[model samples]
Target: MSLEAEIRRLRELDWRELDIKEAGVWPWSLQLICCLLLFLGIFLGMHWYLVSPAKQELQRMREQEVELVREFRSKSLRAANLDTVRGQMEELEARMEALQEMLPTGAEVPSLIDSISEAAIDNQLSIDFIRLRSPSSQEHFIERPFDLQVRGDYHRLASFVADVASLSRIVTLHDFTLEPGSGGVRDLRLSLLARTYSYRHDGGGT
Candidate 1:
């Protein structure tokens, strides 16, 4: 058969039998629109409910990691500064120990007399007179010595001065005077010098 004849026969035979529904008219068009809307709704729902929150959580974790790194570096620098100060303190302590070892050992006597007077007052002794005098010069030892004059009843004065000599700071008495009392007893008059030494750390005279 010729091509023109075949075309004519195909066009004439199927006009009514092959007719399909029109896609642009009411029901069919509405169904296609509804399908498109359903797909769009599913995509938007997943993005709002699931994917967006996950992305926000990932960003928060990244920010926290950066802050922690900065804090760690600051703490490390402070630790290094503390170590340097500790080294300097140790050196100063060593120098203080050496100076203390070279100094002479002696007593603080004025402090001892003060302690004795305090004890005598606490013990209810009636002190009539108290005096302190300048120390005597001595060539043998480096010391600052002073004399104490005390007047009281015999027993109270003896006990007070004896207690003063027994103190830890090392006091030595050189002389004392006593007078006779009226009731077959003696009133005490004490004149005694006590000595102590102090060392100068700054190379000044002692």
Candidate 2:
């Protein structure tokens, strides 16, 4: 037969002659269950593998940030306290310098003599006499005045003289006298006084 004749015979088949079943709920329900299961599995896998770990890591980072903030606050407080202490120390040092300046400077004989007397009293030494004189014309560095003094007791006089030397003003011991004590111990008498000169700056006298 020809190809056209066969196609025409195939198309002429009756539709009512074919057997077809009605749609049932069982197969549709099974397909719906499979789809639900697939969706649920995807949700659980995402929670376990991705979402849960991300949440935990986020929480850990938040905790670390909080700790870092606390540390920063503590360090800032310490820095502030250090600054305050430094300011106080600077103030104290300035006050000390001011006090040092208030003391006698140069060529002031009375103040130097007073300091020596105080040293003698402090060291339990007896001052026989204190004499102060201006430097002779032949002396070097004549700007500073010259002072002389006499005292008694070996150890006490030595300590007294040392204390006088420790004064901020400049003093020198030019001469001394030693004699035997009542107990045969050597007693020393030192004649010393501090000397300071009139200091002159470019502007004026100091």
Candidate 3:
């Protein structure tokens, strides 16, 4: 039929006369409208139940992929510099071992004091006293201190300090004091604290 005829038939149809049992006899326009509505409902239902969740899952997976890529790049950069980092670590360890050698062991401290005395004698400084103080425990080493007093000329006293510093073991001088001695005008008395260290082995000072 023509479009105008269909429209006129739909407009002339009776109101409140439609029934399900009489659907087979309904106008063609009504049936077409119902079919279109049914198709639209089915499409909306499918999108809500199936396609929406799948889209959400796909979006989540994409975000996860981005994070994984970032992590991979960071790890790759570290891997590329692995050899250089290892070499630096090894060099540091070697220097640490060398420094540990400079620190004397507990048993060698007496000999270290003897070396100090020899330095004083070599510099023509009179050894007034060279007494050991109580040892102090540190986190990774033991600090052994010596209270030293000597009498000499100014030049000799400076020489003795330099000699003590040049010893094979690490000996640090602290708290130095100088005063006039009773002997003569050029006489000088030197008093100082000398500190030595020993490495702690097996969590104990050696």
Candidate 4:
């Protein structure tokens, strides 16, 4: 039959008189239409039940892979600088040790004061006083001040100051007042302050 004849026959068919038990006797066009509809339903159902979730999971995995790659790059940069970081740490440790040596802790103050007296005597200066004042505390160190009174010629006083500055221990001189002795003599009565610092430790540290 022609396509127009098949459509005319489908329109003339009496669905009210169709027998459910005799579905095998239905028109071939009607059967083809039902099969196509069923196939489309199954395809949509399969996509919703299976393919959709699989696609979502694949997308999530791709995002996670991107994050992993970024982390790998960051760690690689840090690994490349590991030797340089270690060298900087070693240099800092050496500097800390040297600074600690320069600033001795408690009970070593007297020996340091004695060293100053020896320096003055070696430079031909007379030491009248080497009085240690009360120590002043700071956030990270302690400052111990000493009042030094000496009398000598100009050259010897200068020499003594230079020697004190070059000591193995760290000492800084400040607040100097000079008085000239009487009668054409170059004797200088020098009074000055010397300060030494020590590192402050946490919990009775050295």
Candidate 5:
């Protein structure tokens, strides 16, 4: 029908009196309205079920790409500085080894005692005794204690201590007791605690 005829039919018809059971017999105008409504519902359903989830996934992938780019930049910088880092590590290890050499092991204890005896003799102090005590535990090393007794004048005692400190192995002195010799002997009695350190490792001793 012509557009004028269709418009006239729509204007003359009463929509409220339309028969629901006989939809096929409805006017062309009402039928066109129903088709348009059906098409709108299908479009909205397709967008929600298919297109919306795809758009969300694409946004998540874009965010992940950005994080990956940052991670790559950080690793590239570290790789560029790898040689310098390795050099520093080697220097630190060499210094640590030198420090370890200054520490004596269990086998070197006797040699250390001999050195102390020589130092006292060089200072003209008579050696009374040199006694080794049990090792003590410390944080990074073990402490070896020694009890030393000597007979000497005041100046000779000080000189002996200085000689002991000059040894290749590291040693520390503590807890000194000095007494004047009895019966006008003009000699002094010197007693002191000496400590040395040994590196701690997998082996229990040394």
Candidate 6:
């Protein structure tokens, strides 16, 4: 049929006359429009039910892969620096050993006290008393405190203190009190607390 004739038929034909039983005889324009609408609905339904979920799952996996790659890189970097880290740890251990040597052991306390007495005598200081107190327990070491009282001139007392400090073993002096001695103004009596530390090898406090 001519295009003009078809258009005229469509414009003049329909009023409430079209029905499903007469679908085969429907005008071509109407039938084509219905087919296009049905195809569009099917395409939209398939995209919503099937394609959309699959796309979401694919995106999630890609994100997970990125995180795994980042973790792998971090571990690889650590492995590459392993030797340097070990060297640093060994150096720290050597330093700790050196420090531990300066601290006297439990067996060496008596000798350390004798050394202090000798230092006082060497500097011409009269030793009034040298009393060892009970060792105090610390977190990582034991503190061995002692009380020392002596009578001497100012220069001699200073020399004795310097000698004690210069010993190979570590000794810290505290609570110093100096008063006039019985002899004269030049003679002074000094009282002080001396502390030494030893490493705690065992878990129990000594």
Q: Which candidate leads the pack in TM-score? A: 3
Candidate 1 lDDT by residue in tens digits, 72-133: 88888878798787888888889866645433343444455567678678545545444545
| lDDT value, residue 8 of candidate 4 | 88
Q: Tell me the tens digit of each residue's lDDT in model 6 across 1-206.
A: 88888789889986598897887888887788779998999999999999999999999999999999999999999999999999999999999999899999999999999999999999999999999999999889999999999999999999999999999999999999999999998999999999999999885667
Q: Highest lDDT: which candidate?
A: 6
Task: State the lDDT of candidate 4 residue by residue for 96-130, as single tens digits.
Answer: 98988899677888889989999999988888899
| Pairs in steric clash, model 3 | none
Compared with the true structure, all predictions reach lDDT values of: 0.62, 0.63, 0.93, 0.89, 0.90, 0.94
TM-scores for the candidates: 0.37, 0.38, 0.75, 0.61, 0.63, 0.73
lDDT, candidate 1, at 35: 75
What lDDT score goes with residue 196 in model 3? Answer: 98
- For model 3, how does the per-residue alpha-carbon lDDT over 28-71 read when each residue is reduced to its tens digit? 88889988999999999999999999999999999999999999
lDDT against true structure, model 4: 0.89
Model 5 reaches what TM-score against the true structure? 0.63
Error of 6 at 169 (Å): 1.8
Write candidate 5's Cα lDDT for 1-206 as tens digits: 88899889889888888887987988788798988999999999999999999999999999999999999999999999999999999999999999889889878989999999999999998988999999998777899999999998889889999999989999999999999876256699999999998998764654
Give candidate 5 misplaced runs (Cα > 4 Å): 1-41, 123-129, 136-142, 149-162, 174-192, 200-202
The 10 consecutive residues of candidate 6 with the worst lDDT sum are: 14-23
On the 0 to 100 scale, the lDDT of residue 192 in model 2 is: 50
Regions more than 4 Å wrong, model 6: 1-42
RMSD of 6: 3.9
Off by over 4 Å in 3: 1-49
The global Cα lDDT (0 to 1) of model 2 is 0.63
